[model samples]
Target: MRTAATLGPRRRPVALMSFVAAATAMVFGVAGCGSSDPAPGADLSPAATTAAEVVTVRDPWVKAADKGMTAAFGTLVNSSRADVTVVSASTSVSPMELHEMTMKDGKMVMQPKAGGIVIKANSEHVLQPGGDHLMLMNVASPVKAGDELTFTLTFADGKSVQFSAIAKPFTGAGESYDPGHPSMSPGMSMSPST
Candidate 1:
């Protein structure tokens, strides 16, 4: 059989390009098959903190909504010697509050996290949909797909970090809202925060 070694160097570039194209197409095709939600900003690059090296935020993004409530999702990693608590957050679109969703009596309920979010030292905290996330209540302007929102997180130690999140349209109704538990079935209902 004529192997790649025997095919000579001229045909190598063509074979490589074809292989790359096929791989890229396969990746996109598989990603599209997972959920009906648009994956436009799913591949956003994680951003780092410029103010402090001990804390780093990654994969920050916001859900697209017209004028109501929405949330910011991301991962917060703490590499410091002491624990850090995110006391509050502020955004130009609306007022921000730390909220969490959970399964209560076979229903998903959203509530305000009174003490805010805590990221322990040498550990990571994930702020995502159906879990502990930053809430944007009563948004003034419309947040459409491909839009960016800037927000700043203030810690208890008076240190703050600023980041931007890309807004993408999403349907969070189907999420189970169970933090760290995936065995539960999809579909979560949220009640007004108390």
Candidate 2:
């Protein structure tokens, strides 16, 4: 009588067939599990959605001034799918207003931004010096370098984002304020942050 080891050549084929059979079974078993219909009374409702902040303030900083007026500059990015307008700004130091610069006749005129600053979906609204900026008027005290100020930005959707801006002495000759700007005066000094 031949033992299984003695019939090695013939037994090899049988072993391979058994392995193939086992592998096929395992593959079908796992696939069948995912294809099965849901059990009775199973909850099929979609997942609940949560409100997320879509507005982001980047590199916010306040320009230090000797007088009672200064400005804040930063980039406002809107990540939401809908359009958003920044309606107003508030701070403890003074009343804040969104300002925009435009050429009136031959000179630049800086005034309150009309209809606020509109930040479109997935776009950025840059608030920089001598262009679009946050004007802090009637400040209670002069802002010094290294001072921190808290500001709240309100949007059209009743959503508000609070951020802190550090006061810095920014001195660059590339941009200049309009002559009619509230901060421009004979004794007033505009020093850029170092």
Candidate 3:
């Protein structure tokens, strides 16, 4: 797994003054992102206060080996002084859910847990095939290996995190990241381009 951070241009630096002032008091501060409707710099509900726990989540990637079913995996990080719970997720897909890929009845299955996965304060979780992941059902288009997907995460406190993914299949894909997703894989992985 590799990690990198790239900050984008601030869309609203002025409107955020008040929010920033409040967040600064709590010791958490983040340049607001998401939503074209937010005032100059209006933040996504949970302002960054030191006690506010800031988080950065990467959208899940559907392994190239995906067939009728597959999973998109990524990471979530709480970069704040406090802790938080990721309440929900909002994406282009409907009934957007947080699902887990684990061994059930001794067979690898991607099932939805009771509540959304918890992203601990200052902690991280990896949503990968054969593990915790976001299940994309009936993918509208075929995403070949090397394609990308964009998604957003809605936190319990109402904060939003956005990220994208580059598609890749599991090792030998037929089994490693298989989620039996129904719309993801067909027991095939792309051939290597030599």
Candidate 4:
């Protein structure tokens, strides 16, 4: 993926992970609408398997961009199966691609990933900004607080899981490890982990 040199004047991407390569992966995206209602046919049943595990994406959120661009972050995990390929993703925007941001040749570039990301059945992948972030090109509208969006993950094995994530104001922070974000610094205090 190709990423912009600076997500903003204050936030610098620090997360390290690839959006492509087809071997263990992650993806993040913006909220199409605000989060409040429930998804149709929401299923929390355990997937029958030889091993005890839950397949899901963890902590997904979108970071606001000043220039009508927004980035997504989250974690992908497969605790039961070792062969899972993310076929595709659907969002409010008709066009969405798995992207990664990094300092390449002294510039930030964001680009679409080749093929798709493959996750080993029992491992996890991180989708962090400045690295493997989901970019919503030509944002439909100005997403703000109280807005929720829907994202569906399609697996290679014909399984589609729909999850809803809300858009949080981007104060320079990008998910869990955006140290260069405007909200953090060496002199700043770190909140205790719950």
> Model 4, 1-194: lDDT tens per residue?
53676454654344423334223322222233437544768643433332213457789887543334566678887776455667667787434566655455555555555566666667887877556656564456766645677887776666677777777765643322223534233553221110
lDDT of 4: 0.57
Candidate 2 residue-wise lDDT, 16-127, digit = tens: 9999999999998888788465667864532111112777889999988776667898999887666778889999998878888787767655667889988877789898
Specify the highest-TM-score model's number.
2
CA displacement after TM-score superposition, residue 24 of candidate 3 (Å):
25
Model 3 score (lDDT):
0.57
| TM-score for each of the candidates | 0.62, 0.64, 0.55, 0.55
Per-prediction CA RMSD (Å) = 18.7, 9.7, 19.4, 29.6
Give candidate 1's error at residue 84 in angstroms.
0.7
How many clashes in candidate 4?
18
TM-score of 1: 0.62
Candidate 2 has what TM-score? 0.64
- Residue 182's lDDT within candidate 1 is 34
lDDT scores in order = 0.75, 0.75, 0.57, 0.57
Point out the higher-scoring one by lDDT: 1 or 4: 1
Among all windows of 10 consecutive residues in model 3, the one with the lowest summed lDDT is 185-194
Candidate 1 Cα errors over 4 Å, as ranges: 1-53, 173-194
Cα lDDT of model 3 by residue, 1-194, tens digit? 43344555546777688788887866632444435446876555443453223667655565553333345677877766455665556545333557765676676545565567776656787776455667554445565789877777766666676778777756622233334444344653323210
Question: Candidate 3 at 31: error in angstroms?
Answer: 25
